[model samples]
Target: MFVLELGLIGLCVALLPLSYVWVKASDDKFRKLVWMTTFLTLDLVMFGGFTRLTDSGLGCPDWPGCYGTASPFVAHAQIAAAHAALPSGPVSMTKAWIEMIHRYFAMAIGVLIVAQTAIAWRARFKRLPLHVSPWWPTALLMLIGVQGAFGAWTVTMKLQPIIVTTHLLLGLALLGTLGWLAARLTPIPVYEPQISRYRFAAAVGLALLIVQIALGGWVSTNYAVLACTDFPTCNGQWIPPMDFAHGFHLWRALGMTADGDVITQDALVAIHWTHRTFAFAVIAYLVALALRLRGYESLRRPANSVLLVLAIQFATGLSNIVLQWPLPIAVAHNGGAAVLLLLVVMLNFRTASSRPGRAAVPTRDAAPA
Candidate 1:
């Protein structure tokens, strides 16, 4: 009963965007829908970060529903009981609402993807010469399903560090994929054959970005953001004591070692230090890549976007340490990562799509009749 109600809530939330796209998009509705979905997905990823940071992950202490019910209102008694039992614990009215809102938003995104898949297949059956292939949305649908599974595991597994980190990775993966789909649907204005030369560099930059995001996720999941209270140098020393062995252990409870010992400060420092040091290398490589891409007219916009978001990421990341991990700054830092990933994925798509021998895909100027 609660499952059905939860689905209905998701449907209601999804209808807002679906109706807007249907009514407002005069042409290329499919493309508009995909882009809208991508935009909302980026929002969802950031909100997921908020949910985690607020300690609302276990707000309901269950999967898919709050206290086995649809709305947090229906589960208020249970939530109140838990909060009364432990006022500072993970369960509270506010946290429960936050968690449920996040869930509702995620389900709404899932519904939108389903609509994309359905509309795409319908066009395929009618033999419409759509700019994007139906298989792209189909693949997105599959990826979202895997993402949903990870979401469930993140709750059921008690926010185990690895599972939670993987959940974050999957969310970003979905965001990147949707960005790729949007790029495919909306054709680049100027196709410079030379743009293809940067394809390898863009790919390498994206790969490095993913690794850095994963490291960041590990730090967040383990609550290691403040392990080093200083920037450039950690804890007043350039080389801090760290326990890489316990910090990198994959299959342990949150803040626990494989041997059931409470995790040490050294382990937390290792997680934070590794993420921090590797960030320098990733940033340098990406900034260099963006600078190279900026010389080309066709790649200039996304390259500029990369540079802008990278600056925000750097600023917010520093503030996270210096400001003692304020919630809004932390959330912005996560959002900056998503925006950077989207920009890089767009850069990759532009470079690949402009290759010399490829069949000329429809540009915005040349829509299919």
Candidate 2:
């Protein structure tokens, strides 16, 4: 019964991309489908941030289906009763809706990926105009499936900090994949000579960015945003006391330290301060990489994009501190990080033409399409 309900909801959500594809029938259907899926995935990433920020991660209290049914309306009595008991806990009606909406968006992405996989397989055998290999979409299908599983674990695990943060990371990883694929489909000309050093630089920048993201995720999962309460100095000191042992311990329940004790304020500060201090190194290296690329005219666009998103990320990061983590700014900060990750992914993929070990990168603007 539960599985059937999930399928029903998936079917309902699938109508969106289905209808759009029908209305805009064109030669580039596969590419269009990929791009549409990419666009929706971007929204999903932002909304996922919204869900977490709003504390709606456990709104449904179950996976795939809300309270053993497809919609919150059907579970109104259960949700209301849970709310009446706790009132300000994780089971409110509004939160239920937020969580369920996030699921619907996810289901829609799944359906689109399935369609993409099937179409790519058919096109491969039939020798269609979209003469790309089927394996690409198939790989995306696999990645999205894993992502969905983490989504389920996010609920069943009762929003464990590690699980929730992994879910967030996986979502961003999926966004990067979709963005990279879409960039491949929309090939741009490269008039400037490819530099091996630039590719290496971008790769380093991406690696550092991922590490910073992980640290940031750790801070968010532990609810340490307000731990510092000041800029440049945490707790009004250059470095307040921090219990790194308890803070970096990974396998504890939410709000609990490694030894099953309530996590201390100092531990929270440790988490927050670590992420805060690391931002300097991340920014310095990425900006340097971007500046290096600016010397090449063709790489200037993505290079500038990297710098721009970097500034937005830094501003939002500070706003979260000074502004007390306002919802709009917080969510946008999450989105900005995802965008930065996406930009770096594109930079790495597109610049592969110069990477010594990489296969020949695809480009449609060789002579100009």
Best by TM-score: 1
The residue-by-residue lDDT of candidate 2 on 279-303, one tens digit each, is 9999999998888887776677888
Query: How displaced is residue 237 in candidate 1, in Å?
Result: 1.2
Which regions of candidate 1 fall more than 4 Å away from where they truly are?
A: 363-369
TM agreement with the true structure for every prediction: 0.97, 0.93
Q: Model 1, 16-42: lDDT tens per residue?
A: 999888887367777788899999999
lDDT of 2 at 169: 88
Off by over 4 Å in 2: 129-131, 354-369
